[model samples]
Target: MLNIMELQQILPQEYPFLLIDRVLELDEGKRIVAIKNVTANEHFFVGHFPGLPVMPGVLILEAMAQTAIVLYAKTKHVDKNMVRYYFAKAEIKFKAPVVPGDVLQIEVEAEKMLSTGGILKAVASVEGKTVAESVIGFSVKNIREDKT
Candidate 1:
């Protein structure tokens, strides 16, 4: 189980963008489970819908990607700060709307581990019901900071 502080260290995202609130379970090279607590105060909720706010689909996908990055980082023993993780592709489907006060549980399982990254299967659920699911792909590459 990873707390928010540890997640912040592993993820490059910060407030308003950092979606995964906590990691419930992690199995290196295999799978991960995380959660995002959606609230009415989320910045996107203001514009996504003034009266009927729904969590954006893209953000949901991003949450899945973030969770996968944690798995990839652990499996490959890479320093997350030294590398960049990219969302390569996704075959996603939304089954329901995610609203404020919902605890979005995200689960990702490795489907195919690659040399540079890997393919993963992801799902987001609310109260034990699936709200979204996807097959996501990612790639990791070293971040070259100017040393000269």
Candidate 2:
């Protein structure tokens, strides 16, 4: 159970880039459930479309990736103080359109763990309708003490 502020502290993303709004459920090394409140006021709506604003499909996938990254970070014991999860790859399919004023429910289930990263299955839904789903991959990298 984590709120936006709490999530920000744990997740590296900030402001507009941080996609997930709240973490509803988390089972270490298993699954995670999160939510993102898409609003008409979002910055993307201005450029994506002026008359009919639509939440970009890529953003939906990013939301799922964020959800899975957080799950991996928490479960793998990757020290947040020293490590960050990098967006490696994603195989996703979109079933419906997500629009402004929709609360996206993102659910991720851990499928496999690699030596340097892991894979996860994620889904985003709106009002019981599946909007998007994906198999996401991410890698953990520790902060470099010296960058030369």
Model 1, residue 105: distance off in Å is 0.2
Give per-residue CA lDDT, model 2, range 22-84, as digits (tens): 999999889999999999899889988879898999989888988887788778766667776
User: Which predicted model would earn the best lDDT?
Assistant: 1
TM-score of predicted model 1?
0.94
Give per-residue CA lDDT, model 1, range 44-92, as digits (tens). 9989988899999999999999998888887887786788877879999
lDDT, candidate 2, at 9: 70
TM-scores for every predicted model = 0.94, 0.92
Model 2: which ten-residue window has the lowest total lDDT?
139-148
What lDDT would each prediction earn against the true structure? 0.90, 0.86
